[model samples]
Target chain A: MICMNELQLTVDIYALVITTLTLVNAGAVYMIFYEMFKRFYGAKLKFETPVKNMMTLCGMEVTDEVKHLVPVSEIMVFTFRKAFKHITESLTSEFESKVLRDWFFYALIILTALIVLSLIMGWY
Target chain B: MTDLNLGIVLVSEVLIYPGLMFLVATIIFTQWLWRKIAARLGFRRGPMKTGPAGVLQPMADLLKLLSKEEVRTALSSKRLPALIAPLGIGALSTVLLTTPLAPLPIWSPFDSLVVLYLILWATVSIVILALSTPNPYTNIGVGRYLAFIVAAEPPFFISVLVPIILASRYYSDVNYSIYKTSLYSSSLWGLNPLTATLMLLSAFSGFISMMAVMNIKPFDAAEAETEIYWGIFTEFGGPRLALGMFISFAERVVLPLIYTFLFLGGSSPFTFTDNYLASLITTLIKFFVIFSILAIIDTLMPRFRPDQAVRFLIKYALTTAVIALIASITLTFIY
Candidate 1:
């Protein structure tokens, strides 16, 4: 007969296995559905529709044909890339001007410093 | 006392102190407080006509609802799940007693894991109950709820592990169950910086995830009243609706209580004293603090779209939880 410790270990192992399997299953299902939706509806629902419509509404010029080539499934990725580029451009300009452009930077710096200090002092 | 007498005592304990009676009382108080505070925040007088600034408002509401006849739609299917859905509140209350809310918890080696599963069970019962009605609105709500669950559950599970890992490290014993771990890890946050940071991050992420799990504002896509007409409860009316409301209220109280026990050092504020009453009071205070935080968040934020809610949980909260888990595991090895 297994002791309490052994039983507990077994339970932990079982839990780990179950959690891993569930995550894997969820990921697989999501990917499958995403691919299916993209393959079936990507071309029809491209720019000049929801995304491009929103962009136009926000006064952004949507004259780029290259954006239309990206599938709806990759819209988030494309948006993230554009956002990152914009942020980098802004940061570079701000740093060149030698002025702290955003209050967020100060907050980040202070938070990071506090965390580092806490780490060094062992005062988590 | 003989075995039968002992059995009766155990049953009474489960049904009385820290059990159904206590839980029902707490739920009533918490529901009233939630409404009163929300009203105050919104600059309105809430439940003033009820007993003593709405302290007994929840009780009065419950009585009114129970006095009404139960109603169901003609298209609804499977009366069993709908009838049984409210019983989830009782199941959760029973599970809460297993937590170390008092000086002496109903201790068991694997009780913490049981709590986790029971929570899942409660949520599943809710989904089942929602689906039982077969209404289009409820179907949409269930779809959103399932999506939130898929995104939230992994990080939540991982965050729960952070404390267990830290506690095992603290005790230098790998075999301690979550209940034992939580009991010993009352002072876990005051430990070294790494663990403290990890615990803090985990708790924060866990709290965010709990907001979604408990269907609070911002993450409350499944119950967006404007969009889906109260979502899952669109078809439920009268007594059954009352039960669903009571269940949600209990969930509001119990989820925070669990978190308080797991992370905020349950009863630790009064650990210097040997009095059980002191421990219980301190624990309740901690619970209220957590509850108030949730309340403020609910008041301030707007509801997220289902996709955005899922994305936030997966992209941000899950990442934090994973980082905390890895850090805790690494620290365990180092210590």
Candidate 2:
């Protein structure tokens, strides 16, 4: 019969977790990012007229006045100002803020634990 | 055990009883129970025609969905990960083998980690299926699901872990096994004051997370039919739709079954180690209670906007879990 010791099982469990989360989160992250790109950068990426959705649902910046101000999709406004602006707006969105807050909260806990462990392991 | 014995165990435990087959049976029955409860609460009749008071309605619905014509939208391509939905079912089934429901349960030290991962995978599988269709409504649904996942999953992971952690401290052999934890979960309440409080907080957080993860009312913005046209399944039809729906239907049974065991002390009045059938009956009774409560809550509550749902889950469920986990870690030091 196949069996594992407690230590081996612990290692196996962590391996299973790390691998699964890496895969699942990578796909979810990509899907969300791709959807955001499609929604926000649709007109600019294709050099087509942007759908400037002025009515913001959930207070998101669906309308891009920057597209109207730019003479061409290749202009510097496209390179620096619009890209950063969109990033800032997206980051500042309520959804993004909540998500970021959760990430920060989790990261703080994990990092604190890891640092304590490191000190214990390396203390002379 | 001999090879023949091992093979029998695998087939009986994993395939026949309390595994894939049992999960299917549970889903069929619970779907009926859910509808019946919801209907009664709403002052309506549920599925009285399917099979002896609508016992087979979920099955009939599945077959009907399977028989429908496959509608492929212009957006749906061969590139989408349609196969993932079944894999979600596979994950759910695999996790069940580690619970007390299985006669010869499959287990290992710290295997609850894998169980938690599988539960998360089931959610991911649905999201990946939704992402296959790149429509505006699908995108919005996917966004809402993402927000909900981010808000709900960690709290659940941490909350569930509190039980396992506390249980491990109580028993040398517990080793974070789901079955082991469930066997002694009720004892956790009587440990001391800190653990009792932690259990209360974690259980509350876990229930809220479970509601969000199941995508029921007040947290189902991802599937808000009026707004997003069935949300993530906007472009899904035919076999794909059936499989997507099957994954969801299976989850309604699977997650609650796990919760009943982990939190409600699986077969508490009767341990499986003593009498398997008695324990199984007790487990079923507990599962029904939890299933009914959740279903009634679902029927009574209205949908929350995606943003509102995420914010509430984070503020309440997530905060409660964090406190619970920190307290659990501290309690370990005390003991």
Best of the candidates, TM-score: 2
Q: Put down candidate 1 lDDT per residue, A1-124, tens digits, no spaces.
A: 2232122235555354334323332233223322333344432342234332121111335332223222322433443354345546656876644326455346435544555565456553
Q: What is the interface RMSD of candidate 1, in Å?
A: 16.4
Quote each prediction's TM-score: 0.73, 0.74
What is the DockQ for all candidates, taken in turn? 0.04, 0.04
- What CAPRI grade goes to candidate 1? incorrect
Scored against the true structure, residue B182 in model 2 reaches a CA lDDT of 83
Candidate 2: residue pairs that collide:
none
After superposition, the stretches of candidate 2 with alpha carbons farther than 4 Å from their true spots are A1-124, B79-82
Quote the lDDT for B171 in model 1. Answer: 73
Clashing pairs in 1: A124-B193
lDDT by residue for model 2 (B206-261), tens: 99999999998888887888886787787676556767877787788888888888
Candidate 1 off by > 4 Å: A1-124, B102-104, B172-174
The predictions' CA RMSDs to the true structure, in order, are 12.9, 11.7
Residue-level lDDT for B220 in candidate 2: 89
